[model samples]
Target chain A: MGVGTGNTVLKVDGVTKTFGGLRALDDLNLTIEEGTVHAIIGPNGAGKSTMLNVCIGQLKPDTGTVTFDGEVITGKQPFEINQAGVSRVFQTPAIFEDLSVLQNVMIPAIAHRDGKFKLNPFSILEKQDDIEGRAVEILERLRLTELMDKHAGSMSRGNKRRLELAMCLVQQPRLLLLDEPTAGMSRHDTNRTIDILKQIKEGGMTKVIIEHDMHVVFSVADRISVLARGHIIAEGTPDEIKGNPVVQEAYLGGSVE
Target chain B: MKKFFANQWLVMLVFSAVILTMPIWLSPIGAGYPDLLQKFMIFGIFAIGFNILFGLTGYLSFGHAAFLGVGSYAAVWSFKLLTMNVLPAIIFAIIVAGLFSVVIGYISLRRSGIYFSILTLAFAQMSYNLAYSVLTPVTNGETGLQLERADPRIIDSLFVEPTEGLPLTNFFSLSLSGYEGFYFCAAFLIIGFFISLRIFRSPFGLKLRAIKSNQTRMQYTGFSTKPYLLSAFVISGMYAGLAGGLMAATDPLAGAERMQWTASGEVVLMTILGGVGTLIGPLLGVGIIKYFENIFSAINENVLMAAYSGLPEGLQHFLVTVSSPFVGEGWHLTLGLMFMLVVIFLPGGIMEGFDRIKRLLMKPFSRNKDAVESAEEGH
Candidate 1:
């Protein structure tokens, strides 16, 4: 809304969620404009993951509704929400460990194309050239082509992150949600990941990233939102967020480096 | 891709040839009898269907025998009320078993892991008790349901006169008994094996494997896994049903004992002992267990001593005495020891053992790096 003229892809309204006596999300509202990389940065225990969970339908918001593409999607199943063109990458890579890396990427594309359910037990997987081509393309883009035949579980942490990202990208999702995509990765790997993130931005897929790494945040994020006590403390372009007094006091605890 | 289909066709031909020639090749080992060969084919179908569910999806269903039992009852009822034709009986059996599985799988699938197993087990036990007592009119209870000369065969009698003796289940005019019966079951097994292969290589099968690997990942990947699982459950149940129908087709009898938990356990043992996930492992497991059940259980001290007569008298007697207990009336002991060994050492069953032996033999010719790599490919 501040800079982009694109339509809103996701909107959270008065979302409140509680665990026991503690509120994880307290009347928080946010909007993600189309084709913009939005970063949500927070200190520990600031309900960053809880907000993502609610958006992806992993957890139900107790009070408010979630709107995606102008349709209310509250209380929908995770798969249904995903089928509606939202894909997620976990903090820890959630790739299918037993399956080959190619399959990990191919599965989401198949789901994306085939809808929620299809009973094609007799159709050969090898014959699905379109899906396979998409998977291979995504893998090559993420530099995962060499590891396509390897089991997903056997990949290094960085490679698995790339693999998980490949899995999401293969779906051509309208919106991508990544939770600490470089969490445990080396600095070299993190830099390569930021490059990969930049490469995919041209596809016009809106992204909401929950990151602790300031370098990743500033490099890929177009707009930054600082979260504290389950609500947005500040929202602006990265440079504005860096200079904002409230965001510095609440999240950074000092001026941005 | 064409090469894959070519390989599949080659596998089909070789399987058919082997199954068709079982009588010639197995005669030396004394398992060539029609009755025993028929059991092999029937149970081979059972395990092949089972692997589709347990092997691919990783749903350990302990109540499969209930489907088998239900199929038998349905087949016999079909023979009594509808027709004496084998096709109708088998179809009825499959349909009924499919319906039964939907109910059982629907309830049992609500929970997972050991709870899923316990739920299936409970449903099967309840089914057995009902068939044995309250549903005695349908199941025939203690005596079992058998073809009766007095019972109606509406479809068959409409076309031809009823014979005075008890009617035989037949395909058209061809009687399904003796060698013909074995051949009938073998045909079905071959067809079932081919279908199983198709399922193993298909996209649906990939989804099932994904579910088995990590269901949460599958869900987040935009798949509703319930329908896939239920379809697999019903499909496997129909397989057990077909096996049961074949049983009644070959020998015109339906017994409540077929529904017993022990019977379910036998199929599980057959699947695990052969290689749970391998295409042809369950058949080997079935052949071995069925061969032992028939051959080993028939061995007495006299039979043992006669076989060992070439040895010295004292040694022959000692061998007979020592082996007799594990043979006749104690064949389970031998099976138990084999199961134990397979579980402890060959955890992937007989197929894994074969894989290792094949690798070891090839290790000398190939580089160590390639040998290790190829070994990992199958895993």
Candidate 2:
């Protein structure tokens, strides 16, 4: 069911993206309501990551327009889209390897507050009290305050993934796009991440997640979209998608749980 | 412990002490000359600036010498046209070089990695060719730009009458020559080092490091890296320009050859040799290369022979012959060998070497502390 308040957050309309002869996204159309978690689950070649990339302006779509909060964001730069209150946690956990966890988290918050380019070349980092406070608060919320000074590169994969999430969350974006948040984590880590996702859900920031883990998918997603061959095969609640034979045959391997 | 080492004032104190006492300390190594020490300060400024761009952002610009050359030209022009007041010359040089870098950096930063390096290298070569050939009216071409008694010093003439001979570049009555010029240049070097230290600790500097660490993450994090990159480029250009300004202030000559790619490569070598992205490592590199350039290059066959005269007659002659190539005309060979060894053994440069030694020295103290802590735990 939709939000019923009729508040549409991200609208992907007639979006077609192609790689030579192969269509990665074949005129895919989808709508995400405000304050909801929409999970896109699909097979390997179903273009889930490609869809997220197009939405985030990392890849330009061929014959369609993707609008965010009614702003045409199809051709905008990634940083521009990001500045417009959209944050994405990369699939492979992109982070500033040379910096500490605190710096990794602080960068996004500074960018968000200071806009695309602020020439504060002389302003000391430690002197930015507000930014430091916000960054510290977010790291604390993510239970990463203990490891704040550890190098981002040296962090374990799960912790790095969490740090990436903290980076995204620090911006307090209107829309958060996560690509496979729990992809390579242990079940214990996966469960902890699910708790985090659920915790953020209470804050009412709309989330568009592309996930493969069925457990993570069902645990946090408010709604589900089953994508197959660059198109949505079915769209409904997690329970409804679990019972959908088309999704079961295509992605769920004829059974879920 | 890290905080104590990172204390900015303490670092600055040590830096000033070492730089100010260079004449006394470097005397033992036969490099205490004011001229040689001035070269150290000037190149130290250049290397520190180069480190800001290359060290922080990982943008290996091979055209920095163009900015230095531009600074030299601007400074000399100021001496000829405006004033020989080293203050105006330095300021004018910085402004000109900064604008020059803005143009070059804007275009070069459009590409990244080796392409950026190539673009910068090409721009420098273009600048050199222009100055050496086409821009003869301004640069004086191959003969180089020099001050003549006939030329007007408009600002200097306002306060004092023209002299029989070309007067020295001065601050009020004090001539900027010999140790005076070295101290003048050293003052700029200290100020430049302070600016660099601030940049390294500043959020802006951290952002540049982020660009080096992960460009994709920076872009996605909503940082438009071009402004940050261009600012670094321009700042380093100004620093190179400052070095050039000091050079002309002391000698009042500008040559197109200063923009050669070899000169640009020298700064890169200095930065890497000392330690890229370090506060004092670039200065250490400058000290090493300039020391070799001045001292090692002066050691002739006669000097080597005299030093080894205490040895056996045959062995003395043999030792002099063996060590001769690495000195005088072959000083560059020693520099090359040293660079190679550093690159292979100490990739982090002299700073890493210092760190290793410090750790080695601290081992005994740490072991005692560890033993004491373990005994207390057992109790």
Candidate 3:
């Protein structure tokens, strides 16, 4: 299978990261095209999440460069990287649980428009109807409109994950990163997440998803990369990745289909 | 403008009404005196500013009293060299305190949680020591910085005689003393409250709350949390400075003890005892603590006996004996007990208690509304 027809949006070349004696990411290279869903699948302790962290500026690699849309983002602050059009959804759903669901989504939208900092201490926040409208629109699409007034921490796990996604999507980032977005979700919730992701894919936003579920992997990924021992072992289309013996032995373990 | 007033008119009305009538109403409770009332408004401003940082951002600075002391010094110096007018003194105080906070906040914000608290505490203690010893030439040593009659008052000498009794802080010819002083403080208190209200309803305020809720999530959401925290810190320090300036404005004295760590701790107690994150909580805390300090400490055995004279002799004796430890010089004991009770039963402080009571009172009305809604749905 051939790579998707688009320019490279993100490039991770020769990235190596170490935590004391353990090597988390070792000379890893990845190229994700714009407007495509790329899945990085690996077994536990295989550095899939670590690579995602490196890409998102959460962890700096000992040696390598992370270029997003052609500008280097390595060693940039997380907020700076996010400002550069990269957004991430964590494995455990990092959300402002104390704030209402509406607030949770509105924050990123505000950040997207206002940049890193804007001190408008006198303007009433409620008067920003456009921002509120956009937040509500995203909530409606995520089927979270009914829960907009509810505190995000009180939501069920599935809803929390969806809210986290809504937060990222509200920013309308050019590149989205998901670290095991469907890690602990139920099958029904997993299917629902897949539907949402498919809708996002149709919007033409580039995505890098680290998922373990083969069903999720096969359903949404336009291209697949298998990782093992802190290195990318294989890269291809889903069908090619499924047939590749090295990917099967290293991560897939057997025929996934 | 109408819309803005429409939203805030009730708060403004109530605040003005309460502060304006405080002198009249407090007389009944033996707290109508200018000195005590001035303390209320000054500390009320301090607590309100402290609430902005501690309440919104959840970064507790234990060195806030340093700013307060700095403001007092700046204000006193202004009165000595510049003018006896309170305006320049207040402005100088706020700017000095703001600069001090920028330095301290920049260093303290590097570490959050308990470390931030300790760093602030260290800075305040250091300031206190420096003021008491090495900075004596500036601070006037342990006797504290006092306005001297011999000091040249360029502005005051041009207008009035310097040989006159202590030069009082004034707004033009209107002296900042007696009922006028109380009104002056009350006006500033209203301004402080209004500013805090605006902040509470602003996007900047929302960001501060977001920081309080989750700093890591805020950073990932593309917010540089440090600058936001620093802004809050400086704003809070300016508030403390304003309070200090007001204190010096009224009394015309600046003491090293004002910058002590305990003074910082007092503001913390005022904030927490009032409510950590509520708009009106810190002011209420200030009122309660100041009331206890001024009124309760004045309640001697004779006053207690007079209050309990109607009771049976044995019962009155027993009551006074049991209560003696919690009144007069033991007023701190009462404050401590109240703090413990509030912390234990109302973790959200006095505002939480008010909220609980308000909820309990509104329970029946809310249930009726729910019933009406359900009936409409059934129809």
Which numbered prediction scores highest in DockQ against the true structure? 1
Q: Tell me each candidate's TM-score.
A: 0.96, 0.96, 0.97
| lDDT measured at residue B360 in model 3 versus the true structure, 0 to 100 | 95
Deviating ranges (above 4 Å) for candidate 3: A1-5, A254-257, B1-6, B368-379
i-RMSD of all predictions: 0.7, 0.7, 0.8
The top-ranked prediction according to TM-score is: 3
* lDDT of candidates 1 onward, in order: 0.91, 0.92, 0.91
lDDT of 2 by residue, B17-65 (tens): 9899999998888888899999999999999999999999999999999
- Where model 2 places Cα greater than 4 Å from the true spot, the runs are A1-6, A255-257, B364-379
**Candidate 2 local lDDT, A123-236, one digit each (tens):** 888889999999999999889998899999998999999999999999999899999999899999999999999999877799999998998998899899988889898999
Docking quality category of candidate 1 according to DockQ thresholds: high
Looking at chain B only, the TM-scores across the models are 0.95, 0.95, 0.96
Of the two candidates 1 and 3, the one with more favorable DockQ, higher being better, is: 1
Residue-level lDDT of model 3, residues B97-180, one tens digit each, is 999999999999999999999999999999999998999999998998888888887888887877667777798888988888
How high is the lDDT of residue B330 in model 3?
Answer: 99
